[model samples]
Target: MFTPQGPTLRELAAQALSSVEHGYDLLAPKFDHTPFRTPDSVLDAVGGALRPMGPFESGLDLCCGTGAGMDVLAMLCDESVTGVDISAGMLAVGRERLRADGPPSGIGERGPSVAWVRGDARALPFGPAFDLVVSFGAFGHFLPRELPGLFAQVHSVLRPGGRFVFPITAPPRPSSPWYWALLGFDAVMRVRNALWRPPFVMYYRAFRLGDVQRELAWAGFAVELRALPEFGYRRDGSPRCRMVVATRGGGATPV
Candidate 1:
């Protein structure tokens, strides 16, 4: 929910008219205050899920707006946690936030290192450097067609047997009002994109889990869906949210 401190309607409209990168730049300052930011519950849940697999040497947070996922990396990784985003303004804010969080959990992980890099997700700058890669709340920015490239970028940057982790929620059922709300939102975005320039690409229904699973497999990842017990199950007995652990080099010969 948008609060009094959040971006105003006019500001949001202006952002919607701007390029995805520029819009995020414009919104960076107020992003954490908005509902758009990943909630603490989700963050803590993901952190708990990754805790057992921890002591990872290096971790990367892809599209790490305001560095929310950075907290997870800092907790689970033993050395070097990095954040990458296309928006410089967002990266700047993320760095500042990390600093304020204090020693180990914040920007102070520098002995082992905590850094921010400005880069596009499609063509990540590093090569096979991260032991674990995580992203949160940024997938709506990528269209369905871009998932293959995005997954490939993640795969390319992970060391052999490294994992790319992200959470996926169960889609709302058609009979639910939430589903209709999302459908309406996507419809509005399509019309907005058709009429607008600089296209702010965000669609709630675009990245279906089944399609994403297949795409991840095609990108050379052996994808596994681990139920996040923290979020509980839906009426149908499926997890409300699942942590996708996609491992690279699963089929490759050891060096």
Candidate 2:
């Protein structure tokens, strides 16, 4: 589902054939017009949930495609925010947007100074300089087996007591159309990766919340889940969307 300004079918096909980094580079300019961008509503909800817990001085947005998650960090963190991604094209677009939009308004005399760096999330290129870290719609690019190292990387970049936060939706029931759609998408991706080189790893069904929580804990995070009331609850009375707040403690050991 894309708007008229979004990438054409031909462009998308070309992107699919490229490596994940290159594919995102090709898609970066029109990304915000596509369904792939994290929705403003989701970002707002996460901001609201984190507001009470912060006044954080420094924040980082992991896998920050076009810097959407940085908006949330700017609202919560007063000092500075940094966005890191593997795509130089995405970072280029993000830099242009920042220059045009300027600093976000209403956060005192100035909002946080923002910077974009090209770096992989698996090995973030910074010290424990951040009090907060956030990611949006990027975890699907990481395989299930990479969860441990990924979480460890996030933990390593966070100051003690700092949080690695992100929103996750509850999986659809087996009977739901969405469930089948995601299942099919993952199956197709698996087949494509098997047949192709420089695999474009984007599997909708692979990033389960339970597995993620376990990995976060293993990475020495004191994990907590907070329900996003804006999304409401499911028929089973469980939250339809929840924010995972994994805090790095003193015991965190980098891999």
Candidate 3:
């Protein structure tokens, strides 16, 4: 699951015992080495899917954990890119990485000017300022009940006609070993959360694609799902993964 540089079992146990912010802070330095970091392949696939919708002016990466989505935003947005997260330690690590190999500091030089802001996704610090917003691999941290507020926050931050995009893979078939693995994982998390204080909230099965699309619609966004060809199709011929592109609009669109 983790590289040698990633957190050890004891370290992971310690993190799980702490609050979500604190757990992430403790794991921030070694986050990219862990499986929890969004894979570069998914980011590349999403970048390809977004290329047609862009040449966007400004972009935001909500709940960016170590800033992987910023690279995608830089490729699509011409003006500026901002990554927001709740963990200051994670932001600090991201800042160090950006300073090491980030885009040009000057806006409109070569790539988009990038900035990292520490804040919560539920109550964003910005207004309708971004033309494109992307999030990767962070939804599992948010419970099902929190979907409406989270969707509303994303809707509020995006400029009129702007897009809110994210990649969501199909749930594993019940017959597959992966399905039982995830079920066991979620069950263990539930037990842990029940017994633990300052609960470390994370679940693999809570963010259902159907429920998410409906919540996005209720939040005043026109939603569309685009199949990503990179992962190919499942046995049923449906896309293995789809990019949900929600646009801020007055009327609803097909999901």
lDDT of 3 by residue, 1-255 (tens): 699999999999999999999999999999999999999899999998899877999999999878888888888888789999999999998889877774533344677778899999988999788999999999999999999989888888887899999999999999999999999999999999998898888999999999999999889988999999899999889999999999997443322
Candidate 2 C-alpha RMSD relative to the actual structure: 1.2
TM-score of every model versus the real structure? 0.94, 0.97, 0.95
Residues 58-109 of candidate 2: C-alpha lDDT, one tens digit per residue: 9999999998888888888888889999999999998898778876652346
After superposing candidate 1 on the true structure, give the runs of residues whose Cα lies further than 4 Å from its correct spot.
104-111, 250-255
The C-alpha RMSD of each candidate to the native structure, in angstroms, is: 2.4, 1.2, 2.8
**Candidate 2: stretches off by over 4 Å:** 106-109
Clashing pairs counted in every model: 0, 0, 0
Whose TM-score is greatest here? 2
Looking at model 2, report the run of 10 residues with the lowest lDDT sum: 102-111
TM-score of 1: 0.94
Residue 31 lDDT, candidate 3, scale 0-100: 96
* Model 1 Cα lDDT, one tens digit per residue, 1-255: 988899999989888889999999999999988999998888898889888887789999999988888888888887789999999999999878766766455335254588899999998999789999999989999999888888888888899889899998999999999999999999998999999886889998998999999998888888899998888898879999999999897454221
Which is superior by lDDT, 2 or 3? 2
lDDT for each of the candidates?
A: 0.88, 0.91, 0.89
